[model samples]
Each structure stands twice: as C-alpha cells, then as structure tokens.
Target: MRKKRGIVKRRETGIKYEISRKNLHYEKALDEIIRIFETENYRDRTINDYRRNWREFFKIIGKENVFDVTREDFRKYIRQRMQMDGLAAGTVNIRLGGVKSIFSRLVKEGILTENPGKDIPKLRTDEKPIFAFSDRQLKRLFSIIDKTSVAGYRDYVAMITMLYCGLRANEIENLEISDIDFDNSVIMLPGSKNKNRKIRAVPMNRKVREELRQLIIENQENFGEDVTHVFLTTFGEPIHHGLIRKRMHKYGKDAGLIDEARVSPHSLRHTFAIRYLKNGGDIRTLQMILGHSDITTTQVYLRYNNDDIIEQYNKATENDDLNL
Candidate 1:
C-alpha cells in the first residue's frame, strides 16, 4: 500500500530537470557539436563547413532549444533555402546533411532521444545532367594547352593523368613524385590521400608512362630531386585543388568546349572510365582502378541513355544467330 502526502506544487517556469536541459538552447548545442567534432579530429575544412551549415539552419529557424526542435523545423529550413535563395538541389542537400549530422551526434550523446532530421528526404535534383567530353572535344582541349612553358606543361600532364588514371581532384593534388614507379609503370596512392583510406595502385599505359617521365625530368631539373610533389604551380609552390579546377575551366573556355560539355577534373575521370569500359574493360577491374570502395558506385558508369542502349543492342544482337 502507498501513502498519500500533501499535494506538491509545480513551478510555472518549467519542470525541475528541464532547467539543466535548457543548455541545449541551440547556441550551447552548437558549442557541444564543435567540441565533439574537434574531439573526433575532423578535418578543418569539414569542421568549418559543418559550423557554417549549422549557423545557416539556425538562422533560418530562428534559434530555439534543440529539445523543442522537430522534424518540421528541419523541413522548414530546407524549404526556405530552396524557395528564397534559389539554391541548387544538390547544394541544399549537402548543407542539409551537415545540419542532420549535428542532430545525430546529439542523439548519440543522450542529449536527444530522437533525431529531428533523421527521415528528411533529400530534394530532387534532375535539372542538369553530368557528362564526359567526346574524343574530338578532348583532342581540341589538348591542342590548346601551351606545353612549351613550365606551367603549361604542368597543366598538360595533370589533364592527361586524370584522363588516363581517372583520379579525383584531391588525388591529383596529393600525388607525390615518389609514388610514381617508372620501372613497373604504376602510380601508388597511399591510404591517407585516398577518400576511402585504402591503398590502391593505378597502372600506367605507355602514353601515361612516357608523359610522366618527361614531367619528372623537367620537375627535377627545375626544382631539384628534393621536391616531393608530382605537380607544382607557376610560382614553384604546392598545387591546390581550386587552382586545378580554375585551370580546367580556363582551358575549357579557351577551347570553346564548355558550351558542349561540363569541363572539370571529374569529367576527365568520367571520360577515362567510359573509354575503359567501351574498350572491353570489365566492371571489377574498373572498380579497382578508380579506387571505388563499393561496386555499385562503379556500376553507375554502366548506365546508358535510350539512344545509347538501342545502338549497343543493335550491335550485340546484329551478330547473334537464333539457330536453335
């Protein structure tokens, strides 16, 4: 049997423990998030981007307690970004991921029992299509590069390496001169530089091999054997990913190729993969060369439009005989 005592009075402000939980008032919530990200040793760029996105989200929703934040709040932030700012779906989606990751961390730490942004679907993004440059466009792009000078030669080699090796922008930036094995004609990418944190070797064809050799000779003669990076800037400093992108854009603009296709490092990589597959390279082998951690990611390159499908179908069935 339970004993009944005098009725307890409730505070008009809030419940007892709720006072302590008020620290999750979004301002402190962001502070806790920064600490957690730092403790996890996230990259500076990643941390900065996450912080920016959080501020953007809170600015949109007008900063309430994290405890009071609901899924609809997340939806409202996304809607405002799409409607008012006219941001691309992909851009908004990336920022949404940044915002959601904070809620996830809070849930993991027992600060919140449920993640508010857990089931928020990404915005549909079918406005523009990604594509690779045709052989003629690539040839025109190559012809425009001024390979006589050091900077021009550097750009030329960089573009060719991406076409032949199918490397990402960061991978190109991180390529060390020592990673190139002239004897075996292989370029070894260390785990630290790879997105998946896995070591992989990319084989060099005869063309890639000879071009890399020339670049090395020029690099050594000018900067000496002490310089470790495979590519350098016009000022003899380390290459940056932004500079590479801008150079690709410049090359595209100069060659009048930007009108037909998007010009970037990834496009060169896509060109490499499509050519590799069209030349009869198997999916499994292509996966290894591109350093993809999952086969499904590599399989996306296998997708073809209706026109391409019909062409390939006619070619394949054209030779087959139904003799049975």
Candidate 2:
C-alpha cells in the first residue's frame, strides 16, 4: 500500500483539487491558439489583432508557463494595462477578450485544468457618441477634393460610395467591376465584416451610380482591362487600407472638421446611417444596409436628440396649434 496524497482546498472558492501541476508553455499555447484561429477561417487581420493583444498580455505576465497565470494575476494585469498604459476601458476589454480566448483553447485541449481568465470581469466602457459629417461638412469635404487629378477622382468616388452605400474601406478597396450590377442598380459585397460572411447587396443611389460610371470610364482609359479592383493606386494596383484612412483624414482636416472626433473613413458610414434614419429609414432596413448581423449594432448609430423629436412633433402638429 502507498501513502495517499493530501487534497488542496482553494481558500477563495472552497474547491478541492489534487496536488498536481501541469507544465504548459505559454509560447506553445499561444501558437496552438493561433492555429485554432486559422482552422476556424479567421481573417488575417483578425488573427493579427489577436496576436497583438496576446503578445502584450504575455509581456505583462512575464511567465513562460501557461498554468502559472492565476486569476489574481489576470486582474492585476488588467489594472496595470489601464493605469500604467492609459488604455481606455473598451481597449482593455478587447485585450482581455484575447487572453480569454487563449486560455479557453488551452483548457479545451487538456493542457490546463481550468482557465484563469474565465472569471475575469470586463471593464465597463462608456459608449462614445457616434461622429458623423453634417450636410454642410459633407459639402465642404467634397468641395475640397480636386476631381480633375486621377488620385483625386479615385478618392472622390471612393468617398461617395462609402457615404451613400455605407461600404467599409476594405469592401470598397476589394470591389471588382463584376460586383457592380449596373443593370439592377446595386453593388454586391461578397465578403463583409459580419460573422456569417454572407454576400450583401446594397442599392446604388444616383450619386453612387454616377461616380461608379465615372470610375469605370477612368479605369478603362488608364488600365485598359489590366486591373480588377475598383479602387486603384496611381500604379494601377489595388489601394491599401492605410492609404484610404490617411486620405479620409486629410480630406476631413481640409474640410475643417474636428480632429478629436476621429473623422475618418468610418465616419462616412456613421454619417450615412444617421442621415438614413433622419430621412425616415427604419432601423431594420438600416441593419440590412450596414451588413450588421445584429440590429443592436445598427441601433448604436441612431443618435436622435430631443430637438429632433421636437422638430418632428412640431412638423406633425403644425396646423393643429389650437391657441391653447
């Protein structure tokens, strides 16, 4: 007969465990997590995002073993990230999500008995009000773009597509000539940011159709059927997302928009959503237009104020004052 091992009881939760320690290396665990992301068909951009957040977390923990990280350690890491790095609550929450994903994978693979990040609470983040360009600002932005030059005309068309159809920068950059159904007055997006990865068909308004025709004419004249992407650089290559962001910022600044509000490519989407709502577009329809899987995501863009409500009410009761 052999001597029995004593059980260890955790003081915090009163949970009993056998005296056993697992040796799972942190780096190896992270590598496996990345492999899992790849197996799940996560986009390269999304994988890079997870890698960035997890690398930062590993640096903070300074541990080589995955099982060495305790719940307290995770809590302390969150506090350090917020206080020392001056990261906002929302940003920290995203980082926490990455950590949780890593630990969850490790647990699922039998590398760890429990996930330390499972009980880690996400920080409360105050939702920032949506920033959108007003009609005057939109006019100012369009007026500043010199439409005669090739790059200028490309940027103009790109901005107009985003403003009317709410296409993301990547969607616009990856757009092919075949995606535009000129006969049906619609633009087809094969891959969007939504979870389902379903194809989205957006209606082409007059402005979008006009700019698209112009872009097609310009592309035909310049590339002569060599390029496939709708938005191309001066070299006829597909435009990178970073350049589109920088161009949007430059145009926003030239139009005298506030820099603190982050008036960039995404602001055009916000502008489109708000304008659509104000012009009597329903939330359900806006959801479909924005390619959002959840209607709650679209609702975040609906920022109506009391003044707007009063204006609508006054318009409705304009002839029924009754002089009370």
Per-candidate TM-scores read 0.85, 0.86
Model 2 alpha-carbon drift over 4 Å, by segment: 1-21, 192-196, 259-261, 305-307, 310-324
Instruction: Rate residue 239 of model 1 by lDDT.
Output: 95
> Which residue pairs in model 1 clash with each other?
none
- Model 1, 1-324: lDDT tens digits are 876443332233121224334435576677777877888877778899998998888889886677877788988888898898888889999999998998898777666679888988988887455488888899998888999989898889889999998988888888888889989999999887877778999999898889888987888888887888888976666797677889989999999988887999999998888888887898999999999999988887787333468898999999898888
**lDDT tens digits, residue span 1-324, model 2:** 987667655443233445465455566567777877798889888889888877778789787766678888888788899899899999889878978987787677655678888887788889887777777778888898999999999999999899999888778878888889998899877765344598888998987897898898888789887667888998888888678889878887887776544667888988888888888888998898889988888888665443477888899999895885
| CA lDDT for candidate 1 | 0.82
- Global lDDT of each model? 0.82, 0.80
Return model 2's CA RMSD, one decimal: 5.9
TM-score of 2: 0.86
Clashes of each: 0, 0
